[model samples]
Target: MEISNMDPPTRAGAVETTPLLEGDGKRSVQAVDVVPMKFRDMPVAAESIRKAFEDDPLMEYFDAADTAPFPVSRRKLIDMVDWMGAMHQERMLTVEGGMSLMKYGPPGNQTNLPSVAFLRDSLGRLRPEECAKRWKEFGAKARELVSAAFGEKVADMMEIQVLATDPDAQGRGYASALVKYVLRQGDADGRDVWLLTTSAYGFYEHFGFVTVRSGKVGEDNPAWDGEPITLRIMHRTARASLAQASSEPKSPVMYTV
Candidate 1:
């Protein structure tokens, strides 16, 4: 997760901060605040996502052709997030000052076609030719793989796209808060939620999402340009089971800064 709020200083003269979450044997971390991504938050959210995905295999592959001074271009990331954030809006975009997320409503709730023009325009202007080419080429295949893995019925679910908490905010419950917020929404609506992750498979397992498939990008896939990349498709079924599990205490509500 990307950074939001830093851990309260333990040094002398530090002010007190509220402890975030407590329950049965769960890992304890200070809590960071969260809120729906607003238009004003676009720039910060974009940068947060860029940093969050910097070490991600797929993301690194996408940026392999970037000539920017930094490993990733902040401008391209901002444009990309702007396009996506416009589509997901309040339902699936949440943020802490430095942490942010981009998720989606259940499949068929909205058509992504309208957003293509924005992506194309943004990528054309901001991304290198190779990077943009790889993005478009891989997008369709990724969706196909997800559909094939889950089948149509269950594939029609909410998806968590980008979850980033700033490094300084690591160990805080920000990531968990963003995830649980979406899961709770899905559970309340009785709709399944889905996500794809590379190395963080174990983290989501804590939230009850089960892995349905895991595989490497094929040699022919545009994203496989000499880099080894793998992804896991996971699903958390609707709230029926979650509600049953509700006898357990809940994680605390993450505040908005």
Candidate 2:
């Protein structure tokens, strides 16, 4: 069977920020605010992605070339999230912000923590090179679609973060819509979405991504430089999935509230 597009639905024009109240009924750290990452948030997103990289000794290479010990680049940060959202329908939002402490501030040493700060690795992983390669492959189309959709300097690359909905919103398919949205963006841009993960391979595979052996990836990638870790890669064509999504009856919506 040929695969098709599974673009998610986007309800709002931009990220919305809400306030998270504490048990004492005071404002929490995240302030219950939600916003799709903007140009201004690039720095904060970069810092956030870096801290996430720091938590994983295994993922350190994601920060830079094997020779470089620090971050690969700030662009890598935006690219990571952009691609992540694109690949995951910007689904990383629920866990995006809270990752800082786990990534940077302290080693499991947080003060006045909010519930949003889940685990550090919540957004998942990516090597800078992989991000760039996919972006280059998908850039031209992405520039056209994303530019038209958002009206800005949408790079051949992108970054994304999406929040799952609440129980009150259960069965509404928010998560599914977000997933579809990213896939649609990829389709419009003519790029295949790529991502790495320790688990949840099944979820993505259903979308038509085949699991690639980590060995195959390591050997294929020079960045592994002959020392790739135990990792798995999954990817699907952005355009095809969107085509499929549009042609078929939508799947049953699954909510996370």
Cα lDDT tens digits for candidate 1, 1-257: 10111111000010101223457655465544667666666666566655565566666666676554553455445445444544454444555643555444454443333455455455455566776665554454455546566555644567665566555555566777777777877787777887666667667666666667655553465544575566566767777654464354333221111
Q: Cα lDDT of all candidates, in order?
A: 0.54, 0.34
Q: Write the per-residue lDDT of candidate 2 for residues 208-238, one digit (tens) a residue.
A: 5444333212334555454443333344545
Candidate 1 wrongly placed segments (more than 4 Å): 1-25, 29-33, 68-88, 110-116, 119-122, 218-227, 241-257
Q: How many residue pairs clash in model 1?
A: 6
Where is model 2 poorest over a 10-residue stretch in terms of lDDT?
Answer: 101-110
Best by TM-score: 1
For lDDT, the strongest prediction is 1
Tell me the TM-score of each prediction against the true structure.
0.70, 0.31
Candidate 1 residue pairs in clash (backbone atoms < 3 Å)? 1-165, 2-164, 2-165, 2-166, 3-165, 3-166
